[model samples]
Target: MRLAGIHHVTAITADAPGNRRFYTGLLGMRLVKKTVNQDDVRAYHLFYADGIGAPGTDLTFFDWPVGPRVPGSHDLVRTGLRVAGSDALAWWQDRFARAGVAHGPVEERDGRAV
Candidate 1:
């Protein structure tokens, strides 16, 4: 089966405020919604998407606001999101560096500098 592209991706965040700041304020993604978790009233469900989300540009989070998950489901090592091109990557790299956001040096992967 051939997949066109990603419609959305979901992840868990230990810090909802920090997550909101980073994804929306820093990365420029818009907050689509902020809702409470049905199971856990203390938790939150934060959804973010690129401006006027079209395709391949939605990120959501199930937040546990109290603290980091220990010995549980939050073990994802990395999540890759594609941008316009190498130039855009360079721009983001510069932005990250300037903002003190930790990021690896841009490297080529699958013939694309990421």
Candidate 2:
């Protein structure tokens, strides 16, 4: 099947409030939607993204309290956000640094970053 782009990426989280704080407050993504998971009515499904809740910009979480953490097995992978250009990368790097968020040093990649 051909895909135009990603709709969203969903992840499991243990703490809903903490997740909300990190994504919305710290990361500066808008809390687009707050809802209950369909299969598990009590659990939450949170969506965060830029303005207007645009697709491909969303980062979603499913509250799964019983799930145990599994480390060192690639269970968690990094998510990369694509910025507009070198200027955007520079601006983002500065913003992240000021917020004390640890991120990789900016580097030239495919004619971007620089």
Candidate 3:
């Protein structure tokens, strides 16, 4: 069997408002929908994506106010999104700096500088 690629990724956020601001305001992603979790109506399930919220462009978040991770607990390490061209990385680097988003310098990964 073979796989094509990731369709979407979900994450937990302690501060939903801040997460929304960061992704939509800072990173320039569009909010596809603002909805609540089906199982837990009190929590927010925010879906963000490109301008039109394409299939593979989804980045979602679940609102959970768990205070910080306990020591030695398993946690999400990293998430990456691919841009169309090398120029996009350069643009993002500048955007990150301007928006005060901490990001590492683009380095070679899988034979491409991402």
Ranking by TM-score: 3, 1, 2
Q: Tell me, by TM-score, which candidate is best.
A: 3
Task: Return the clash pairs for model 1, or none.
Answer: none
Q: Which segments of model 2 are wrong by more than 4 Å?
A: 66-71, 108-114
> Local error of candidate 2 at 28, Å?
2.5
Cα RMSD (Å) between model 3 and the true structure?
2.0
Q: Candidate 3's error at 75, in angstroms? A: 1.4
Cα RMSD for predicted model 1:
2.9
For this target, which candidate reaches the highest lDDT against the unseen true structure?
Answer: 3
Can you write out model 1's per-residue Cα lDDT over 13-111, one digit (the tens) per residue? Answer: 878899999998889999988998788878899988889876678888888644554576657757887789888999999999999989999987788
Q: For each predicted model, how many residue pairs clash, with residues at least 3 apart or on different chains? A: 0, 0, 0
lDDT of 2 by residue, 55-100 (tens): 7898899998845656876687567767687788888789889988
Give the TM-score comparing model 1 with the true structure, all chains together.
0.82
The model with the greater lDDT, 1 or 3, is: 3
What overall lDDT, based on C-alpha atoms, would model 1 receive against the true structure?
Answer: 0.85
Instruction: Locate the minimum summed-lDDT window of 10 residues in model 1.
Output: 65-74
Q: What is the lDDT of residue 55 in candidate 2?
A: 72
Q: Report, for every candidate in turn, its global Cα lDDT versus the true structure.
A: 0.85, 0.84, 0.89
lDDT, candidate 3, at 57: 93
CA displacement after TM-score superposition, residue 19 of candidate 2 (Å): 2.1
Over 21-97, each residue of candidate 3 has an lDDT whose tens digit, in order, gives 98999888999999999999999999999998778899999998877777668887578877877899999999999
